[model samples]
Target chain A: MSLTAANIAAKPKPAATEGNGCQRFNTMPGNGAQPKTNYCASCAAHDKALCSRLTGSDLAEFGSMSQHKTITAGQMLFSEYDDARYYYTVISGDVRLSRMLDDGRRQITGFKSTGDFIGLGTDGHFTADAEAINEVVVCQFTVPTLNQSLEEYSVVQGRLMEMMQEEVINLQNHMLLLGRKTPMEKIANFLVERAKKYSGVDLDGDAITEVDVKLPMSRTDVADFLGLTIETVSRTITKLRKNGVIALETAQHIVIKDIEELELIANGEA
Target chain B: MSLTAANIAAKPKPAATEGNGCQRFNTMPGNGAQPKTNYCASCAAHDKALCSRLTGSDLAEFGSMSQHKTITAGQMLFSEYDDARYYYTVISGDVRLSRMLDDGRRQITGFKSTGDFIGLGTDGHFTADAEAINEVVVCQFTVPTLNQSLEEYSVVQGRLMEMMQEEVINLQNHMLLLGRKTPMEKIANFLVERAKKYSGVDLDGDAITEVDVKLPMSRTDVADFLGLTIETVSRTITKLRKNGVIALETAQHIVIKDIEELELIANGEA
Candidate 1:
């Protein structure tokens, strides 16, 4: 959420205003792994963000400034009103975006898996808290560089706008899902959507066709996400397994052996 | 909600499979609001939408083919998979964006005030249902006009993208609000936000510096929106009034005596 002078070029005239474009943004290279300031560990050529339309030198230019950073679970990447510094792309593990109440009860607003973008609020201070769900690897870009890139390339800007809009739509749908959806419907939809995102079980090899996505958060977190209680999440998952709508390969892993059936269940067919 | 054919000349088209650079789309007006159209009452005007954004000669040209349609409270303006024939704009009243569970549980995704856009989903099929909260009026547009308008104006496209992104942010925030915030915080914040939207209130020709917003939804609907039980909502309101954070003039009218105190409460001040 913020970048420091250590991460960015030092300006002699660092005139008092917190760099709205780039302030206190820093990255933690994976422990004991050689750090490459040029390319992030998880965000190298293998990054899913590379799947975007940017190609050739444009992609390289992007990757160059997208420095590698790391965060452990519960570590605050940035909170509301931190100077806006860098935009992030998750490379490995999960990132949880959340907001808090004064009494300390916090609702995890969103979870960023690999390939998801983390921060993109407007010119104001950060709106939500971005925290890592687990040890996460990410690529951070300074605000000024990002703005220059966005202004220079219309395609990039358009794509960025579209992605932002898409994130918003996803968030809205999740609100409905959390606020009103039944437990079974929530679990079903989560499974299908996660399966779509996680893809390939890596069973025999990378070529494995099917997938079983693990629930990263516990029942409590899932409940928070779905606006239900932990008891409800447990009961519903149990019900799903019993009904053969989904299989519990382990406490964490959910084997969505049938996507179509999962979809049916999510649509309230069950 | 959409205008019905015979009663109106516009047709709604599905957003599914809609690709870019859409210059060839025909704006020819048709008749009637189809049951299948995703008529979001909120999305009344899009900078790129033809029927809603038309002006001067353009308005006159399109008006000849348009018709006025009214929907009664609690009736569906459109449902999922409705063939897109006409686009709609709410002339009056409010609508709810919702999806249902087969067993009858309902999730209200969003509420549309005047000038809000509705019915836009990926597949040209409405992802949810639109229901009138009261008597509602809509003007319809053919899909061709919408696509044509998008192709012609880049600025409009930019504005459309910005609006969509804002909607997304609202949803994401709502997810946090519903999933994490407590009952009192939810209602207080909801009221505060609505007051901001309505701006100021008039009382007996004297200006009320602080305004109280009447919640448009029933307790049951409010429960769904806040992810709480109706009892919780009722109890929370009582507690708030007792705390002197707010005063209830009637069952529907809420007068905020101290907005700063309300904000403090919303932020978890004791």
Candidate 2:
């Protein structure tokens, strides 16, 4: 039983030891109906982010600490070793978190999208570089301001802790993919995750046979994320298309024709 | 600029945005002198675990909820899909956390030792199997008991959140290693972490030249952990020994004679 991101993040429980049961990152809705500030009232991430925990005066105060920032495509939100002055919640678009070796070998650790948090680090320095794959909007919070909010609002603290736990689980599942999966399995797995995130389908029973999936990042990013060469990634995608599992609409868009078959390949069952 | 676990966990910064400055797992002394109960006074992980946040009455009450249990070598503390009824803090010995594919492909996600926490899962079920590498002693807390303690203690919540973030950073670093690093670099990086954890010497500035390191897990475990074949792992170790960078004392023991060179190789610099 290989641990895919879908299975790992989809498991639902009534309650967790630390917080509301294991929340899947970027997938949880706000806990309850809370009054939204004028500034955050129209924000897409407002309902899904830690800020969702605040309401009334608490919400206003926390919203005042945030600054909405836009990063252009191919621009870095933060680079490795930069002082982590700000943490972010993505409002829209995709961000790739990566680490590069001295010789220029790069590994994309994760891709951040709408409602995803970024800029976690150690020792006041970012652990990786987060670059925008497309023009991105993010809610930025200075370290001190966010820390103050965390202390003053138990709701924020609880939600943030739960998010961190979910992140750890996601990373652990990714580790299995990186270390153990074959190139075809890796490509299939990536497509499966894309279908889950962008397709807007419940995917509970795999009832939907066709789903349009977007690939915001380039093939190099996909290769780096999956621990494969770009050629291998291309060949594998072609192999899947030839097998009628998926069809490419364009360089950046794909149509998953048979998600069941794709899922089987993702888990190496095929 | 590779993000190794040592650097990710070792970066010391005062006054973190979170609880403390990215405290390393299995390191970090307790915050301050605190009154310890009779039960926790002699426990090895008492000062390093989440219980470190408790004192006097809080300590006693929390200590009462823990059951000190020993697991013999080759036994599983928990298995994949098992109900995560209890969480644990390792007081002694080692536990290997892993996931297995249906065809027997296993990926060792992490190895937990003294002060390491385990039983993190999704949907109230474990995502991986945690098995004892040796005779292991752990302090166990039922899920409900731990949740109650977490809600009652802000200090505990803060510390757990910090630990979870650190775990995320550690996993991110490991992802780079598994996805991009060469087999020799992987083995060297593994040894560098082993030296930092088991050698009981400050690795800063390359002060120490000779250090004895123990490999609690077998060759098969090492292969799985590093995403390599057993032959590759063995050949790499032999290469290191022949190069005079290290000496094999026994199957489970190693002596790092040239730690500086090992460090260079670990970072892919040598």
Candidate 3:
């Protein structure tokens, strides 16, 4: 097992206080000890997060229990079976969640980006290893503190349930992709999702001709996520580029030259 | 494309009163229109269901809004894109939930049995098709009524959250199986899960040597759920039988003679 400094701790401690040779911030304010800064008001993810349901004192109280923690690229936020004492909402960058077999074969379950909530559906322990695909910033909350907030704020509780419902629907869609989609369909679908998530190109909204997409994870991670070999993923992307559906900017970036064409392929209607 | 009598309607109406040529009951009691009997107290799935958190008048009031509907084998309870209306708790038999690709490829996302909630994470429309694997009975509730109960009872909401958490965890594990595990491993894992769910033979509990597992769904359903071909599923089962890990009592029944060995294969440890 590849152990990280974050997974070594058995108890729930503030990641900001752990001197793990990484960038960390004690951003919890309004707790009497720290200078009261209305952090939630200025946060980029505030409007999209579960805390958006709260206003004034409720938002401040919830934000006080939250600490800002930075995870370096390629470092683990937590491993499978770790004590799931904290919940996080991604502020920036990306995190990949995965689980492994006894023989060391890994399956990338899902990727979380900005405004995404993590650890909402966990029991007492984490079921997957959460690793930073890029330098990631997250607002962290202890389970007790979050649960208490849920008890006190029905709106927050309702919002959390809504988020979880969306998560379930996403997973169900992903399950179809993993189980049945062709390699080309899977790659196209992945790009379409990234375009929507990263560039706000809505499939059902106004038609957009082109969008630049950033893929922070490696080809191997992409292959794992799509349940295909890396060679298949690379060859399929090359096929798309040759077909003039997309243009490669780099190994980590691409420009979707024909979004509608890509969507047709994604839906297996091409 | 296969529309059942249940899916022909677009509005939220009680399935019991629809005269759909299926077994239906107006079991909702204590609403001043029906006889007052504590139906929940005698329900087989009550102790294990979300309503277990309620008692006395609370349970009675919530149960008053629930209707029991029976779907014959092979009939659809709902289909994809159907207007989301009723949520169900399986009282008996099995239901399969699946999604289909545009070209007619299908992927079975899950199988719901007794005490399993059918429609918790849906948005305003059902994302997948739900069909009965056998004659299935389920307690049904309208979405608005369920929402009202959730707002009135915190314990029910909490229990629903816990159930969704378990659903997420199960889906994650299945994703691993679908992505990384071999065909043998997938079949073994599926059987082990069935053994646990149908027979209650906890892997961590006792040293039970044998368990009879019922395969309610067809081999095609099993193949779709496991991301394998029907030929591969049958071949894997034959291999297991030849190795004495399991025995085919019939086409629809399996006797796990060596569960430990089966579990080892499921975990890719053998």
Candidate 4:
């Protein structure tokens, strides 16, 4: 059976346990404590997100139309075939976008983090399922509201187009990774890519032996994303650690000991 | 070692022969033909392409900015790392968008046909290489020209955004096919998808015993696109034919004898 939101809600909630290696958190309703004035203008992701192009009255207008939403780990933001009524901009945390076959085999298409936009579907229904990987806060806008605003703000429209173009590029890169890369290369590429997401870090800090990399998603999620088994994922990580390419700070954190080496491996040159 | 435009140009041009199972045609220079008025409005792809939304003066302006060119099968339309100067809309034939690793491993990300847009790059450089699968005709426009047109025509801008969103959806579907689907399922899905591309075909004609489907791309291109080896692709096609699901009219044409059976195989239910 398909894992719809209603199906998930109907099922008995699993215990909030860490033993299974799958992280879980309880869903909470909105607190309604957010600031009313110029929310988009003051957003932390404003400069980096599609909203950054908006200014003055346009930015304020977007803020008025947007609602802040928080989703706990394991809570689905939307499911396949869900009505495409909302557009989302990730404020914080990661959201895993996946699709499942009839037999329940899943493929994680993407992991959206800060400043990433979601729910830009052509058809009225979502083609994939999106679930919160951790505590995720997003600025949500109703489709009609966003489309009206886009009509008024050319800059906002341009930014949205640019964002979509970037999404296409990202998807193409991931396609290559999925279609051609080896398992070791996939892991290395994933790590390097995840590192790049955390911009402003000293990526070329040769003196620094290890740089801590946060991995909010579990190994299973990583495996699904990379089209590998969980055992393969674990084994590859362990092999990288043994080779001094990476170090495990925790189950959810990795330390890149050799960025150059990882790059070489990712490019299949090592 | 990279297959850059320079490398392609440096290599000796293959003879324009069809006997090799690949059609090679010479790249023709742009010619200022007759009937300059109402170019976009009178375009054959106007109803199908993004230009359909444009009207009157906007259409005329766009037509003035676009140049039509034909590229042979072996010609490179654009290469990875090339400057993103022009945007193209395929008027006829197919183009393969691909990326290659430094070690020469290639991944076919997409195959664009009639009315499909190309070169919507996020950065100033193209992320993938585009080559004509056969003799192809395309309408090309400079990036600045298209951006200027988009600013003037909101309909054009909206259409572009819609196209990008559709591209994201397509990429997600392909990701599932690459990462999750079995080899047989992949081939089945590919055939079904290719059949759908041919508009006006009797896709569901219960009375029709078989329907012809054209495949402009070679088996090797198909294998690369589906993440399978050529031998595996051949074997899978043979199996489908032996099962009475399809018949090969030629290496490039497939006749679907049982659409229901193909659908079942595509869904992994058969």
Measured against the true chain A, the candidates' chain A TM-scores are: 0.76, 0.84, 0.87, 0.84
- Candidate 2 chain B worst ten-residue window by lDDT: B1-10
Interface RMSD of 2: 9.9
- The lowest-lDDT stretch of 10 consecutive residues in candidate 4 chain A is A1-10
Off by over 4 Å in 4: A1-38, A204-209, B1-42, B202-209
Cα lDDT, all candidates: 0.61, 0.76, 0.81, 0.76
RMSD of each: 10.0, 11.5, 6.4, 8.4
lDDT of 3 by residue, B92-155 (tens): 9899999998888889999998889988557666778899999998988877788788878877
Q: Residue-pair clashes per candidate, as listed?
A: 34, 0, 0, 0
Ranking by DockQ: 3, 4, 1, 2
Model 3: lDDT equals 0.81
- Error of model 3, residue A58, in angstroms: 1.8
Query: What are the runs in model 3 whose C-alpha is more than 4 Å off?
Result: A1-37, A203-207, B1-37
Worst 10 residues of 3 chain B by lDDT: B1-10
Interface RMSD of each: 8.0, 9.9, 9.1, 8.9
Q: After superposition, how far is residue B137 of candidate 4 from its true place, in Å?
A: 1.1
Output the number of the DockQ-best candidate: 3
**10 residues in a row with least lDDT, candidate 2 chain A:** A1-10
- The stretch of ten residues in a row with the least summed lDDT in candidate 1 chain A is A1-10
lDDT of 1: 0.61
DockQ, Cα level, model 1:
0.25
**Runs in model 1 with CA error above 4 Å?**
A1-51, A57-65, A72-74, A120-123, A147-154, A182-185, A201-211, A216-220, A228-250, A254-267, B1-77, B83-92, B119-123, B135-155, B201-210, B229-250
